[model samples]
Target chain A: MSEILLQIDGREVEARKGMTILEAAQSAGIFIPTLCHHEKLEAYGACRICTVEVEARGRKNLVAACVYPVEQNLVVRTRSEKIDRIRKMILELLLAHAPDAFALQDLAKEYGADKDRFEKEASFCIHCGLCVRYCAEVKKKNAVGFVDRGTRREISFIPEIASKECWNCKECFPLCPTEALQAAFVLTKALFSP
Target chain B: MPRINSATELEELRKGILSKRDPNKPCIAICAGTGCLALGNDRVISAFEEEVKKQTLEAKVDIRATGCHGFCEKGPNIIIYPEEICYIEVTPEDVPEIVSQTVLGKEVIDRLIYTDPNTGEKAAHQSEIPFYKNQMRHLIGNNSKIDPKSIDEYLALGGYSALSKSLFEMSPEQVLEEIKKANLRGRGGGGFPAGLKWETARNAPGEEKYVIVNGHEGEPGAFMDRALFTGNPHSVLEGLIIGAYAIGSHQGFIYTRHDSPQLRNNIAVALTQAEEYGLLGENILGSGFNFNVEVHLDIGIFVSGESSALMRSIEGKNPEPRPKYIRTSVSGIWEKPSNLNNVETWANVPQIINRGSEWYTSIGTERSKGTKLISLSGNIVNTGVVEVPFGTTLREIVYDIGGGIPNGKKLKAVHFGGPMGGSIPESLLDTPLDFDELAKLGAPIGAGGMFVLDEDTNMVDVTRFFLNFLTNESCGKCVPCREGIRQMLKIVTNISEGKGREGDIELLEEISEVAGAASLCALGKTASDPLLSTLRYFRDEYEANIKEKKCRA
Candidate 1:
């Protein structure tokens, strides 16, 4: 395979053609923050934590690096003041919604997000579509999917399919960044068994 | 009925159909559109049928239930042909008088005619009405002319002549070149050029390409698509078949609102009839161009109206927006080249072909070509759909065409584009309705929804209302959209209810910056539009709520 070239954080790096900006940055010893990406699954671009300013197609757009493909003459700024401010605001939003999520708490502190700025809604499950994708892709069980839309959107386990197909050891439970998934599973299970 | 082998056969069929129909006979066109149906047009329809059958004048008189007349504020409407007398707010009890006096005896009823609220003068003809006179209805004007269930009515009015012209008269590249020259832009909020979008899919490397009609007009205070689909479903179909031929796509889909059963049924019947006549299926009109269309109702969510999210819904997945690094036109719907145009945009193609691009381009502004269908609603006198040229000022739209605000209320502001759009103050009402011009003034023209706000309406409450709507429909896929919209909704709601703080505006601006840049799709990116525009123009309302803990109203 031929190696492609792209500029990331003022450093010249060689990458494969199909590699995402996050993957290319990682290969060049750079760390870009992310919440919904996993090497084992497809790029979802849901969390938007790993956003970077990219100039493509004659326009400068702040795009999620986890799903943006590398192309020729692609100029990427992985870390900038504008990027930091946007990432901090997104992290601050997450902290207000899911304050107890451990990964989110760590990232919020790293990005200097003020958790107290926004009123606490007392809810979990930021709906990153991680566990949903894990169940559908890796486990091949198709037991979980997203239900509803917007803030009302939640991860719902298909009880009929979960009971029939997802009988193996619960491998996707640990993949969740928040404890909301565990609580959801219990609630869904209770509804089905009762 | 055999398939039309050539364009000559199609023209012959049109001549035969037109020869059998009488132009002098009087017909009763009663509006059966959704709004009219809600207003008891069903009873009026049945009453007309019973009275006509009872009097045994069925041969002498024709009664057809048509679509919207664009005067929904005055519907259960009845219009008599040849004389062109229009009667509004008609009930079943008034049908006997109408059938005998108007249809049988050629007389007009005095009380049933629409009395202008301004001049107090009664107008009986559809052409003389204030709402229909000042405005140019190029697109929506067809609704009052045809019955949606009968293809013969559509056929007689030169419906599929454009499709026949596309297959026989022009090459695929020439058909595309004309649309590009006409500068027809997408009416589906995005406003991307339809010709350029089609060119990308047509040139993309793929053996299979798809065309989609986005009938999912979910924007609030907007029902023009519903009116068009329920009124003239074949215009959209003919445009779609012409587009598929131009883009070299075989399969097409019309994604519409699930709640619109009438729209879905009309489209289904149109598709079936077009197929039975060998106009839609393989070897269409014996031109060897095969195309098929299917109707897909949305799962019923606002985010499902997004192009990428809509594609995901059609693919049997949850309607969540994916990254648009790959344009849906280049790689969409099973990673194939897909061309998606809004309902009104597709409906314009047949007209552009039938009348020539130069004639079509001679209508709207220099940049924004052709007329736009606007649903004139909210605080207006004559509330219905109005189609005007692109450069028509907001003041003209609100005053001359809309009959000004009702109840003598002061026009405070005009909101366009629904939740994702911004509000402009009344002072800037003279701004021309151009795509780029509207975006320049904090308020962008989105999907042609013109909502007039009067003086009594609270700015903070309106901002909160739009933000709350975006929160319920955000799809929760991206962090900035889901979380950012939630935070903004909280602050805006606080300000509305007299619980605002000093730093709320700054915080909202900060969140707007993040959400606008980092959100996955247009829904999240522009979720802060209503809030930001309100803050820019109505900062006094926000400051009063924040500093004094009281609403200005």
Candidate 2:
């Protein structure tokens, strides 16, 4: 792999080819908050908490750091007023679903986001896909996956597979950013178990 | 029919097909497009057949059910060849008179002809009609002439000659150069240069590449793609083969709506016929080049029309979009390079190759070349598919071609690009139809869905309605789009229902900014375009709804 150099938060950082901005930031010990991203899986880019402003070839654009690959002479701003506003709004939106998620609460405090900024539905799954990706990518079990789409999208455990595999494993239970995954697993257990 | 093995053989086949057709034969061409079919043109067609048989004029008088005639408001339309007399809204009762008088006696019917609602003038010929007169129909002009299922008819009309020329005469580089020279832009919303995209996929370091025809006309008011694709499937197929040859790809995919069976059936028939005639498949035209096409149906969501999502769907995965940090032409469709163009965009390729780039460039503006197919709808008198060259004024399209707003209502605005696009007020009616010109007014002519809104339409409610559509159609993969649209829809719905607060507009703008900036794909990035443009021009209505709690509309 070839070495690529870029600037993040006014500090020069060196990265390898095919390395993502979030990866490079992490290698250089730079702090960029994330929700749906995990090193063990492919970049999902669902949470969008790691969205950073990038300037390249005299063009500025907002891109997800976890997915956008690093390039030489690229300028990345990990924190900006616009990015802060976006993160704050994203947290507030996610709060409507899972207001008590500790990850969201931490970010909400940091971004000065009001938990009650929007009305609450409280389905409680932030749709981070951590459990889904962990089950599929790391475990190779395919026990949990996403269902439906858009705002109605949620994680569901395969009853047949969960019955065969998850009862003994239960490894993905702790990866949920909110209580919705556990609730879903409990509902599946109660509904499908003989 | 045997597959032609060489360019000379292809020409011989064309000659054979044309020689079989008589120029002086009296042919009654009935429009069988979806619009006309919905208006009972199929019944009219059977009526013509029965009349021809009952009058014992079956051998002498020919009844041909062709494609869309473009004058959908006045369908089921019929045109008699040799004399070329046009008739509109013909019923089964009038088919006997049409067969006797127009087909045999050469007498034109006055009641069935197109009469100008304003001038009380009658137009007997299709060319003289006010709607068809002011427009240029380069792409869809042949829709009324040829049966979509017949490969011989397509060959008779000089269809695959462009493919023959590309295969026998020009190299792939030369073909790419000609398309680049023509400056052909994609008609599927973005207006991105198709030539540049082809060059990218061609130059990309992958031997295995794919070309796709994006026939998914998911935009609410856009049905012109269906009209052209269904009416002239061979033209689009020929264009796709030519594009595939240029891009050095053997496989092509036609991604279309699953709802339209006619369009799908027409395409399937065209593919089989083309393959049978050696216009497609192995060593096409015996030029030692191989190409084939597969048809993929979308799962019926607006977001599936997005390039990445469409590619994912083609791969049999969930139809969710990924960010285009890398262009699809560089890495797409199982990470192999892919070049996708809209059905209308592909249909223009054969014409460019046949007529050359200079002749193609002679039609439209400096930047936007050739004619565009606009599905004129929403409060307009003539709600149908219209084809006109670029640089035609919006005023001409509305008044002359569209026949203006109905019921004597005043014109308020014209919306373009559906949810991802914006609306322009009547003050900007003088704006030309150039891609950049319409985009400059914040309403990109996306897939050419033109919605003319009358004075009674409320802009706030319109914006809210689009937001609601995006909310349902959003892939929900990313936070900003799924949540931002949900929240924005909530606020806009409240505003539309006269429950708007003072800071609601500012809050909507703030959320729109976040959604526009931080969203995953173009669907999320442009999700706020309708709201922003409505706010730009119609802020007063939002203010009135919020401050005074009343809708002025």
Candidate 3:
């Protein structure tokens, strides 16, 4: 495979073509914390935990390392105070919805995220897109997709109704890094209604 | 009578059987799908058989037990072949008239046909029904055409030809290459490239390798895998055989949930038939390769679906996921390289191999290739199993395929994935079902579950429902999943009950971050998806519960 050159943490590194910033950083022994990115599965940037500062073409911005592909001559910083603060803010927002979620708590602790920084709002989906990726990419079952645009966007099955195409295979539920997508069996059992 | 060994022989037998049929007699096929079985289809079938014998028309008429007909609401359903006549909501009491009129006189039983709720037009055949006609049945359509208990029915349909080809012609490497070309990914949930997983297992260093078919479907509203196993066990088995050949595994197991007795029995019979035909045991069909399969019943537990947890259950241990740092392909199932795939994933194998990979890849989007089977349930009209190509729009599925929402209620939200999946509002309906596209929208494809939401559903209450599930199902092996779920549940509960504090949302975010970052397994790591996605998209619903002390839509 052809290789591309990139600079990370002030060091030049050679990476395989089509490698993501996170993959490039990992190969160079630079750790970028991520939740929705799994080695066995494709990249899903929903969790936003892998955010990193990228200096490319004289522009600097925070990008999710898991989904953002690395280009030649790209300059990336895996860690910094700005990146850390943004991660902490994202974590704080996630905590408001699912404070009891252990995965969210661990990430918050690692980033020194405290409970007082943001307002608490309960939510199950961290918008990691694992379920969407699993359906669209892995299962090739387009039964579910994004229903809205921008901040209002989220995942859904067709026509807002469960279709016959859904095998209820439950493949997407576990892969979701947050509770956005869930298992009905678990949910019904929790309800104790039947 | 001699046993049928292959599709060719089975076809010959079928020809003989059809020739023997009297022109005046009709063929009655009673659906024996799980849904109908629960509704006492067995008794209806036996009653019809007795009525035929009583009328002394046994020589002319034939009675068969077929698989699911898909319309679960109207089962125990029956279909009379040749005329393609369908009978719905059948009972033992209706057997005599069916035998006398439909079977003997070759007349349609007026009361048994399906009447459309709107048009009031009775549908006499399965193909004419709107529920089935609007959707493509592909893999599952075969269920209604065959007798799951009879291996001959399967063999009559060119089954096992793929296995023979793999065993006699294709080397393990060659088989893996074909799969890679096909672009099939895991249907079990993660959608990892199927070919890549097999290649990894084939190349991984280990003296022994094991292949497992994950029949332990723990999803609440999902029954597609179970239906496939019960209605068409051969398809799944053939896929497994090919998968084992590619990975050089001599031993394989079908791990089914213990709750499914019919599926378990169906697989057992199929295994026996395969062994007898020299297709499953050592040196199958004169080929030098050796392969064998066994069925293992699983105690019902949600986490057991995890690869490591399933492996542990098969090894006679408690089912709990081991850390992911140790890949299962390298250190799974008695510390041997192992390959585990769900039932649907295995079922797609023979099709990909037979049709060629390029043909399969041509159906879906650029990145996601081929069709996916989704289990549709909750607040929908045409609820059952459906298969569609990747990148198909949600509007096409929900409105066109699903026949729109029932009772004309205004649409609210749609839940994709499952309890662990996220809920999407109605605004993003045009989004296509592609992997990267959905990821950009903050949701991933889950094991195909789509729960439709209506005005009656409370988002906050729904979030609480999932949190409670994660709280109980969490294995407590990791702090993030175990404790974080508890705290999240409490906060959501407080919000729902009008006791939520102002900073509760912020606290939830903090906990979600820690859990996502530090959890050892996928369970702990992604347990907060429901809360987080809801917060991102439907924060107003949560605010209404907390700040406004209301559960407004």
The candidate, 2 or 3, that scores higher on TM-score is: 2
B1-553 per-residue lDDT for model 1 (tens digits): 6667788999998898899889988899999998899999999999999999999989988898888888898888888997989999999999999989988789989999988887899889977888788778877887877889878789899989999999998999999999999999999987899999999999999889999999999988889988998899999999999999999999999999999888888899889989988889999999999999988899779889899989999998778788888899999999999999999999999999999999999988888999888888988888888888999999999998788988899999999999999999998999999999999887888898989999998989988889888889888888888888888888888988899998889988988998998888999889889888888888999999989998996
Best-performing candidate as measured by TM-score: 2
Binned by DockQ into CAPRI classes (incorrect, acceptable, medium, high), candidate 1 is high
lDDT digits (tens) for residues A1-194 of candidate 2:
89999999999999999999999999999999999988888998988999999999999989999999999999999999989999999999999988899989999999999999999988888888888889888899988788888777777777777778876777777777876466555537644772
The CAPRI classification for model 2 reads as high
The local distance difference test score of each candidate is 0.88, 0.91, 0.75
Indicate whether candidate 2 or candidate 3 has the larger DockQ: 2
Off by over 4 Å in 2: A184-186, A189-194
Q: How do the candidates score on chain B by TM-score?
A: 0.99, 0.99, 0.93
Which regions of candidate 1 deviate over 4 angstroms? A159-168, A179-194
Q: Candidate 2's residue-wise lDDT over B348-392, tens digit each?
A: 999999999999999889899999999999999998889999999
For candidate 1, lDDT tens digit of each residue in A21-133?
A: 99999999989988888889999898888999988667887889999999877889988899989878877777776788888888878778887767787566767777778
**Weakest 10 consecutive residues of candidate 3 chain A by summed lDDT:** A185-194
